[model samples]
Target: MAVQASPQTLAPFLIEPRFVPRVWGFDDLRPWFDWSRFEKGREAGDPLGEVWLTGDDCHIATGPYSGKILADVIAQEPRAILGPVAPRVESPLLIKVIFAREKLSVQVHPDDKLAQKYGDPRGKTECWYALDSQPDAQVAAGLKPGVTMDQVRAGIQNGTLEDSLNVLPVERGDMIFVDAGTVHAIWPGSILLETQQNCALTYRMYDYGRPRELHIEKSLEATRLTTRAGKVLPVSRPDRTILVDVEYFRVERLPVRSQRSSASLAASDEPGPGLSYLFAAAGSARLTGEGFEPIEIPARGLVCVPAVGSAFVLEDLGGLDLVRMSPRWPAAI
Candidate 1:
């Protein structure tokens, strides 16, 4: 994980995929990536909920960084691997491909203030980018207008809590932001790319007759009763477009065509020191820089690119569509 390289010498590298099972999950994942390669311990009928693209424990899959975990890379070469924007040596963002076959639990996350009070480092604020969806697929975001905590408690007791939620229909390419304190749930048949804070602290309020533990009091304390509206409508752009920009992270959608040369992908001027994550949603590409060999990234693959004074480019792109994620300081915004 530790590489004795300067920031300018760093190259983009791929991470191993981690498949996670859940009760409300899909048996097959399609149109995003093939799930056949990941059926070792899981049976054909077992539900697979998530594919974690990058994490502290995820192994580097390519280049000299191969066989190293992300956490070790950060610890050994914090600045050269993470650049100037990283808040700490550790990665600040977590990315996942979520497939929901059934409704997720009605849950809420505490804000940073509440999280610190509970002895955690930070709270969770996440955004979902819809990759594919079945008909009638929707998400319960926030609470209904004029709804009160008393009413929410009553509905939960009577099993009518969903009626008090603001359900929003979803389709391909739609972006939905879920801030901390917003009560939310992902409905069935939705495949989404979720980007969020590294923390996994969720306070569940209800779970639709499942025998899961309920954090009723904690959820009530975290929930913001006002109408939960966090959808981000992206504007039309030719090359790159900002999807969501929050204090935790900024996400951008970038398109590349085979017609464009590698030089076209690079900035007109050299980029300053920074680190960014790239996810290839469609097609394939090769990441190239001055110091390393071109790293081929398959469709639906993820890459972490760290730049010092120079920038990296997506060469040999065959109509690739990418999602770029970068961390941001809350104080700057």
Candidate 2:
């Protein structure tokens, strides 16, 4: 199945989000989602923990592509939608809002080599940019320095694995990188915007005695005593703040000042063509471009600007705190 985009169809648009139910989720998403717009709330089923912005099954919410699945759209016209320079045809990144009421599983993810060996597409290397955090909120990023794999296995068996983790305090607007092979867990108290490679291969080592299945052997094999997982410092610019730029993706914080005129796309000066994801983390804004109608993004809404589309400008509708994320391919590729 294939769909072609006419001139009228090539415009920045919105994609409906997919909600995932989790035991560690909250009953009321509140500011993130209005229950009135959803099917049902706590009365119907489990609490909602994650709202996936770019899931494969998510549908295009606006323009000529409306009602089409994201994966199918990209598969049909990868270069037109994802940019001619995109590393792969399919979507390269998965963006999600992670809400945790309880701790997540103490787990590790494989790298590209190990993932391919296990018949998976790729590995998971993700970053977290805090949207909100409670006082004293912290996350277990990696193992304590010099903690060997033998000790990690012993701790898991003894139900003392948490003690071996190096817990780091997290605050709002902080960015942390969690590369592959990092033993990590997200505890209660923060809402995180997670950007990662489009892969989900988790090997759980411990789960606080939960009855769920464990992958001790594979986890130990994928674990690293010391990992490149910790807080990330931002590189500030006059117009925006570069949150994190890795081989997978680059995210920046664009603060919309109360201006009389629209502002040009932040990356308009860069060479080559690419796509941009505008995430309204705090307030609403408007996206305008040539050959298309103005698209308005509500608070917490997400919109995609394709490379083949016309040059775009952003206008402040309210106090807009926008985060722009774009994919980054390896230089070797």
lDDT of each candidate versus the true structure:
0.77, 0.81
Compose the digit string of candidate 2's lDDT tens values, residues 121-162.
Answer: 788889999999999789999999888888898999998999
lDDT (Cα, tens digit) per residue for candidate 1, span 1-333: 322344545667888777777889877776665767653325667788988888777788877878888889777767777665555667778899898878899999998888998898888889999877888889988998899999998987888899999989998888999999998999986789999988889998889888889999989898898633567988545666778877787788876655343333333322344667788877788876676777788888998875442345675467687887867655421
In model 1, how large is the Cα lDDT of residue 183?
88
Worst 10 residues of 1 by lDDT: 261-270
Task: Enumerate clash totals for all models, in the order shown.
Answer: 0, 0
Candidate 1 local Cα displacement, residue 4, angstroms: 15
Segments in model 1 whose C-alpha atoms lie over 4 Å from true places: 1-8, 35-45, 259-272, 307-310
Number of the top lDDT candidate: 2
Output the lDDT of residue 270, model 1: 26
Candidate 1 is scored at a TM of 0.89
lDDT of 1: 0.77
